[model samples]
Target: MAKKETVWRGLIAACGLFLILLTVSIGVFLCYKGLGTFTLYKHSVWEFLFSSNWNPADDFQGGGQVGAAIFIVGSVSICLLALLIATPFSLAAAIFMAVISPRVSNRLLQPAVEIFVGIPSVVYGWVGLTVLVPLIQKIFNLQYGYSVLAGGIVLAVMIFPTITSVSADSIRNIPLQYQEAAYGLGSTRWQVIRRVLVPAARPGILTGVILGLARAFGEALAVAMVIGKMKAFPTGILSPTNNLTAAIASDMGGAADGGEYNIALWTMALLLLVISFAFILIVRKISSKGVRER
Candidate 1:
């Protein structure tokens, strides 16, 4: 029995180590391929990062200016806007589920949220394309509704379930003693929720927000359907633009292997990987803080 347990533990440890090694290998591969755009092509990192003039389709080797500021701005704007639009509604739903009315939540709301999570991203994009796009165009009087606003709205809906579920779980995890104490102190239900429950669950809520943002940043096809794939910086929220993931998805196939364009797309992929790492670090920090508080 002892030997069997030792073997089972070793097998699990091996699987964990394999995953770590696989992750490291992928990172190294991306770094090697991504850095070629600057290192091999003689392109300066500053121009690649800060400049907005991205004309990489010269059908040649070293190629055109590879500025990525436009994509970066588009990604940031749409994701932040999505978070801004989604958070309040998601939080309200979470509070209703976890605090205001738990019975109805388990029966109706929770399953609905889980179904939303299971819905394909393409379905969201399709709905946005057919329904939201025309509505936005009619309301805003634009030539087309493929803009940052459209992408943000679509992304917001896609991430709603994630934020709602995480926040609900966080609130539900709060100790019963806290609520009892709040009520004992003559606090109303609303007051207890606002001053006690929300404060206690803030870190977990933040983790969910960051996770949603990370997903928004990585989403490509759904965003591409609504984001117009414009290679320029958006003048406003309603203006058309493109993001890193969309650009990579659209251009990577046509770009020649080892060419400046290909490597630049790879560089954009590396940037995304970096963003994911940052979010993970932030989540870990928040989780540690939450644990210490507990």
Candidate 2:
């Protein structure tokens, strides 16, 4: 039995090592493809990143360009818009379920939230296209089905569950005595929440916002459905736009045959990795301060 256990442990370790190696291999492959865009025929990295034009037919020798700032602006704007729409709603929902009405913790409300979380993003897109788009058009009198406003709204719905679940867990983890102390101080429910509970849970709340932003930034299918997938700089909240992820995902199939187009797609993926890493670093910095305070 001892020998069998040893063998099994070794097998598990080997599998883990293989998984780690596979992940590293993929990162290296992506890096290789990414560096291809830095070559002689390729546009300067700054020009590629800051330029708003994306004409694949234009060659370096032919004086053509592929600017990505427009896509970055669209993605960042969408993320901020989703954060604005989702933050208050998710935080309020989380606090209500966690502290205000603990009775609803495992009841119908909980299950409904789980159901919302389980619904696929594609379904959200379909609903947005079929329902929200028409509603917005009638209300705002828009000419088109695809617009940044519609995309932001759809992304808000997609990321709402993520924020709420994380925030609720954070609030729930706080000791009961925290609330008791507020009550002992003659604080009303709203006052306790506003002054004590919410402040104490700010770190978690910020994390939820970060998660929601990350989700909104990387969301492809839902946004692509309503964002009009245009490659140009967005003119307004009601105008069509495409995010970094959507641009790459939408164009990769045709570009996969190998050329500057393929290299550009990989470069976009690298940009996304850098952006996500930067956000995570910010999260870590916030977490460190919270640790110091504690």
Candidate 3:
């Protein structure tokens, strides 16, 4: 029995190590492939990262036209919009769940949230296209059903569950002794949550928001379905926009293998990765500060 248990533990450890190595290998491989495109184009990496016009047709030989500024702006705008919509709702819902009533939280609200999170982004996209687009078009009389506003709305729905779940967990983790101390000091429930609970959970909340942003950045199918996918810069929330993920999804198939167009798509992917890593780093810093203060 002892020998069998030891073998099982060894297998579990080996499997975990293998999974970590595999994940790192995949990241390195993608980074290398995406970075190779810039070198092939013969332009400085800075130019590729910052330029505004992305005319792959002008760079058949991989010479120029490597720009991502407009795409970056749209992505940032859409994510900001989603975050603006999701953060308050998620935080409030989390607070309600954590402090108000566990019966309501554990029975009804939590399951509802889990269900929302499980709903496919594609399904949300379809609903946005069919229901939201028509409503917006009727109200605003836009030329297109697909717009950045629609996309942002869809993204908000997708991100809500992520933010709420993480925020709830963070709030739940706050020490009960802290709550006792606050109550001992004659603090009201609202006062304790607004002051003590939220501050203590600030790092986790930020981390959740960052993770939600990352998720929104990588979402392609849903955004592609609602966003007009136009190459032009967005004029407003109602304007058609093409984010980095959408651009790649829209153009990848038509792009010739080893061609400038394909290379440009790869470059866009690398930019997305950089943005994601930056958010992760920021979250880690906030978490570190929270720990130091604690």
Candidate 4:
């Protein structure tokens, strides 16, 4: 039995080491390929970051202006907007599930949320393209429905289940003693929830919010279906724009290997990986704070 246990433990350790190596290899490869735009082709890093010219396919020599500021701005704006749109609704639903109606939530809402999560991204994109786009156009009386607003709405819906599920679990995990103490102190239901449960669950709630924002940021297909994919910064929420993921998805396939365009797209992917790392770090920081508070 001890021999069998040792063998199993060693196998588990090997699997863990393999995963770590695989992850590091992927990051290293991305960094190497992504740096080619500046290291090999001698493009100005500042120009690539701040300029909005983005004409990488203008010549066969793999030379063109490749400013990515517009895409960066688009990505930030749409993801933030989606977070803004989704957070309040998701939190409220979470509160309703964990605080007000756990039985009903378990029987109905949880299953519904899980079902929405299981739905395909492409289906969401297609629905946004067909239904939501036209609605936005009609509501705003615009020439076209494709805009940042449409993208935000689609991303909001896509991320809703994630935020709601996480938040509900967090709230549900809070100690019943907290609620009982609040009530013993003459606190009303709303007061107990607002002042006790929410404060205790802040870290988990924030983690959920960040995770939802990450999902929104990484979402490409749904946003691309609605967003106009214009190579310019949006003037307003209703304006058309393109983002890093959309641009990479739209251009990467046709871009020649070892070309400026291909390298630039890789750079955008590197930026995304960096963004994901930042979110993970934030989650860790928040979790540590929560632990210290406890």
Ranking by lDDT: 1, 4, 3, 2
* Candidate number achieving the greatest lDDT relative to the actual structure: 1
Off by over 4 Å in 2: 1-19, 58-63
Q: Which scores better on lDDT, 1 or 2?
A: 1
Whole-model lDDT for model 1 versus the true structure?
Answer: 0.92
Off by over 4 Å in 3: 58-60
**Candidate number that wins on lDDT, 3 or 4:** 4
Question: Can you write out model 3's per-residue Cα lDDT over 183-217, one digit (the tens) per residue?
Answer: 99999999999989999999889988999999999
Residue pair clashes in candidate 1: none
Candidate lDDT values, in order: 0.92, 0.81, 0.85, 0.91
Q: Model 3's lDDT to the true fold?
A: 0.85
TM per prediction:
0.97, 0.90, 0.93, 0.97
Candidate 2, residues 184-270: lDDT per residue as tens digits? 989998998889778877787788788778778788888888888887677888888888889888888876445767777787887
Residues 1-294 of candidate 4: C-alpha lDDT, one tens digit per residue: 999999999999999999999989989999999987788777888988899888775333666777999999999999999999999999999999999999999999989999999999999999999999999999999999999999999999999998999899889999899999999999999999899999999999999999999888898888888999998889999999999999989888988887888888998899899899899899989889988988
Model 1, clash count? Answer: 0
Could you tell me which 10 consecutive residues in candidate 1 have the lowest summed lDDT?
55-64
What residue runs in model 4 are displaced by over 4 Å at the alpha carbon? 57-62
In angstroms, the error of model 1 at 182 is 0.5
